[model samples]
Target chain A: MTEAHSQRPGVEIEFRSVTKTYPGQDTPAIDNLSLTVPAGDICCLVGPSGGGKTTAMKLVNRLIDFNEGEILIGGSGVRDVDITALRRDIGYVIQQVGLFPHMTIEANIGVVPRLLGWSADRIKARAVELLDLVRLDQNFAKRYPSQLSGGQQQRVGLARALAVDPPVMLMDEPFGALDPITRNEIQDEFLKLQNEIAKTVIFVTHDIDEAIKMGDRIAVLRQGGVLAQYGTADELLGSPADEYVADFVGADRGLKRLSLRLMRDLVKVSGENHAAPADAPTVKGSATLRTGLSVLFASGSRVLKVTHDDDSATVIGTVTLDQLQDAVYETAPKAPTDVVVAGEA
Target chain B: MSFPTQVIPNFSGPNCAGQFFCWDWVGANWFSVLQPALIQHIWISALAVLFGLVISIAAALYAVRNSWFEKGFSALATFLYTVPALAFFLLMVPITGLNVGTVLIGLTGYTLLLLFANTVTGLRAAPPETIAAADGMGLTRNQVLFKVQLPLALPSIMAGIRIAVVTVISLETVAAQVVQAGLGTPLFNAQRNVFTTGLITTGLLAIALALVADALVVQLQKLVTPWVQARR
Candidate 1:
């Protein structure tokens, strides 16, 4: 399975008993953190401040080297790789959008490739390709970062990171600086991009909602850089590892679990019962059961007419609150079969 | 060459129509007296600023991103500025006695604080995240400093150079007391002879030199930082 995954564009990232301690500080920033993110998944490292989530992500790119243990990307240890060559292959995006004020957007997007000595014509072509990939206008390539809106600058940031088409990405609160509306828009756009590119990613954030929305495997870090829980969003909301994990996930874990299941996924698992045509409060098939429940609760209706994502008015099926409740437990029962390498230490 | 007195022998006060700023006297003495002084002024200011800039760049690079070094170096540069210009020249006179060296040394000392502080500030003008991104994106240490930080720092560095150039031009006038160089020579000679037109003419020439240097630096700044102008 590991060999098969290595051949893919995205490769597995494993943190094996990784511990980091800063000089002049006795306490470890990240104490024996161990988890594995399968190919093409986002492993969100989330906790309160001082949790070492950022430190753990940095260890992957060797930005901040670890005092003990090892980090392996695609089965090879990170320490053996040449540092500059290693970094050039890792896409990095930060909250500042990483767009330096001096460079034009085209130059910014072409940075990594330029560092790799791509031909001038190739870099220019790559810049246009990336601007379009991140949904920016081609004319924006000539503008400086200061002329761009906060959201536009981050799009440029994303484009720059993807310039070399690296297999791994490290994003530290990349959208944390944007307003809520823009954050949601960029998050959705990024998810759509990730679907096509499939880069293994280590995303650091303090926000749990962002973690649950973004992570395929969520690693809930506790104080002192301890891993309290490592599992899918559904597993995290369904059965937290401890009281701290439960509290970290919040009181509305059940509703949060529902948010992870779309009506289309529900129809696939639960059969044609969801295919019945009925005059009910309509919800899109692509939306979460959470949205269906919102409609179910709003109009005092028990069932919702689920429409195709493209044709929203057509009713494919009607689902009740009870049906969604069953889905909360039924979805993705693959279970947490991961190594859980450090035992939450 | 005809002496100023011979050239303007019929003048009432070695002046132009009794005006303090006598244009006739200026025209008569320009090549023989004022023009040489103006050339000397440009040379002194240029050398002082050039030396100051090289030292400031070295100092700024040393002081960058370290608060302790920044504070200590800024304090030293500021102290250099606080030394009265006369005292500064007097101190230099003991080591490199009354000549262009004393004037150059004194004027260069006067520019250190402005140039050093602004260069240090310019080198840090690239935000922490931008620098971090540069590093994270596989830029070597030197590449980050040269390609990223230096380019971002151009406006601040140019501003420092502009002020330093103008300050050195102004200081070169006072330098005449210790060194027989720059516009200060003619102005001092005019003072000794009580020639009103010569005094005012020399003074205005120094001011014009400072203005032209400042404008030239500004244009140079605009040329180097086209990305900065895109914001406007």
Candidate 2:
């Protein structure tokens, strides 16, 4: 492991005018894709199937090499570093949850560290710590991957990626293999985990909703490997760059943005009443503003009561449809957030 | 033809017990004749199989890398498998002379198909995703093959070895006609005089050797691949 890679903090990943054209094909797989994922931030890349979101993420680790321009991690070009060392330092997770079936969970998670030649005791300790971090039971360390469910396997895959405590993580639909219920549960758990670890991430997914949920910043790529817009979810929702982006974010962009903000935050921010009248329909404090609006409409009431996240008995506040609507309007794009780094013709 | 008729004793000759599988002759020849033939049978089979295994491993690895080579070697392995042991021995006589090497060559060639297929299939048995993940985690191509793919493939490869061993043991009897080695030599001698005792005893010994050899390889397979047993 290099000195630069051993540090705990996440490092910046920059893709500058990168283009990847496969042999025997005229059209490039990734056409001059450029995005800067800042340290300690999650930048999700979402688009249609052929938009090259995965190809873009793979380029950072040099899993897929680019023919034009350069990809730099924390200031040094990826080509300059040893390929094995570069990948070992960058966490990678895929939709398949590719845990070695032959290896026990502990060994699977300790793969990169073992590759780095860490002592046995250190690798074992790291496995324990990561299992706890990923919320797996301690006893699971001894079990093989075949014993685990899809969600559990994906968790192991994530733990394995984080084994080296890599600064940057490239995840391609990491939760896509799970059932919807498990996907939602793991997605919530992963978001919570991300808040604590805060590694710079380049997340690739075809689902726009997932991008909106997991990304601090979302890059919306269109067909033909072109970036339509790159900005915060609110920026994309509030002020889309073009008709293509506006359509890509969908007709329900307003509702999608509401899902990003919780009812508790709105209640805490708007200085709304706490513990409103019992007659109003009760909505959980943890419910997003979008759900609050749904409850308001479903109840046919003027306002809806929001209960505390932990103690449902304690009412947090009341929210009106008008208030939720006003919150949506307040997010209207003020200035251009599209920062495409494309330097190609 | 189904029954071995050569084991009948030459009752007309002196000390010939007029019965099938005469124990008296067996007791007298156990150390002097039968024992030597039995030991030589096992030795030839072991060396043949060992040579076959080494070649199969190298060929299988190469075959997996090139599709055209895989296709070509597959046809070659099939053709080698169909060459009857008697014909195989006959073909080797002109090139290898009446030496033990001729017998060894034929016996070893017979094992190549079984071992090669097993090794190649075993190596490819590793999940593609697992291999890709290993590469993503910084393992080189060789490391992935040796560490992940090879271990995952052990069960199939060992299974192939077990089958090849039993097969080579059976084929060594055919080698007796070529180089007068192994149990085949005594069986042929019994046939010349229609001695049921020698024929039955030698044939039974060859079968016993095959059974014991098969069991040994099975145990070895289980030892090397305890994970497969665990899975079951």
Q: Give the runs in model 1 whose Cα sits over 4 Å from its true position.
A: A1-8, A24-27, A272-279, A309-315, A329-345, B1-21, B65-80, B87-99
Cα error, residue A56 of model 1, in Å, equals 1.2
For candidate 1, lDDT tens digit of each residue in B33-133? Answer: 77887888888889899899888888888777667987887898899899888678877888998789889878888888999888877887788889899
Which segments of model 2 are wrong by more than 4 Å? Answer: A1-7, A272-278, A307-317, A331-345, B1-16, B67-79, B91-97
Give one digit per residue, the lDDT tens place, for model 1 in A283-317.
88878778888888998877777778899876666
Q: Write down the worst ten-residue block by lDDT for model 2 chain A.
A: A336-345
> How high a TM-score does candidate 1 get?
0.88
For model 1, what is the error of residue B126's alpha carbon versus the real structure, in angstroms, after optimal superposition? 3.2
**Which candidate achieves the best DockQ against the true structure?**
1
Chain B TM-scores across candidates: 0.88, 0.91
For model 1 chain A, where is the 10-residue window of minimal lDDT? A336-345
Pairs in steric clash, model 2: B6-B195, B6-B196, B7-B195, B7-B196, B7-B197, B8-B195, B8-B196
| Native-to-model Cα distance after best TM-score fit, residue A300 in candidate 1, in Å | 3.2
Which CAPRI category fits model 1? medium
RMSD for all candidates, in order, please.
Answer: 5.1, 5.7
